[model samples]
Target: MWVVAQAPPETPVGPEFGKASPVGLFILVVLGVVILGIGYAFHRRLSRFNRRRLFAEQHGIDPFDREAIDAAMEEAGLRDLSRTSYL
Candidate 1:
């Protein structure tokens, strides 16, 4: 009597394995960290702006009045508004 053994069928690989290599995973983590840092900085800045706006509003002052800012800057002899740029 002779006995034969049969092999099982193989499974196909998926696409996710190809897209996410070790280097790609590292890059994605680094990019996420940088984006998080930038978002935190922007949030802090916005919070400060909101606080200032609220204070101005409480004092019956118009926060968007550029003339008032320019005049204050002129009185203080600080950086000129014409040469300064916002981030």
Candidate 2:
């Protein structure tokens, strides 16, 4: 039969105990490292996408600007929307 004991007042840990078990500490460290690695990978991917979007918005003509696109279509001799299937 398991016997229940009353709690001690002075900190649950006794003076004899120096540190946590080695295996427990090792597991905690490994978990922390894995979490950090995953966070870094996600950060890098987001940064790359942000950079590409910024460059496109600055240098490339806005695809949403219908007037500009129409002007370009006229210049390329593709003014007819019905004939230009690529558009």
Question: Which candidate achieves the best lDDT against the true structure?
Answer: 1
The lDDT, on a scale of 0 to 1, for candidate 2 is 0.61
What TM-score fits each model?
0.52, 0.46
Q: For model 2, which pairs clash?
A: none
Q: Candidate 2 versus the native: TM-score?
A: 0.46
Q: For candidate 2, lDDT tens digit of each residue in 1-87?
A: 998896776755677667778899899999999899889876766665454445436657574665655565566565333232321
Question: lDDT (CA) for every model shown?
Answer: 0.66, 0.61
Cα displacement (angstroms), candidate 1, residue 28, comes to 0.9
Candidate 1 vs. true structure, TM-score? 0.52
Tens digits of lDDT, candidate 1, 1-87: 997876657645687644656898899999999999889877866775675566556656688875775565566565453443344
| Distance from true location, Cα of 24 in model 2, Å | 0.8
Q: Model 1's lDDT to the true fold?
A: 0.66
Say which candidate scores most in TM-score.
Answer: 1
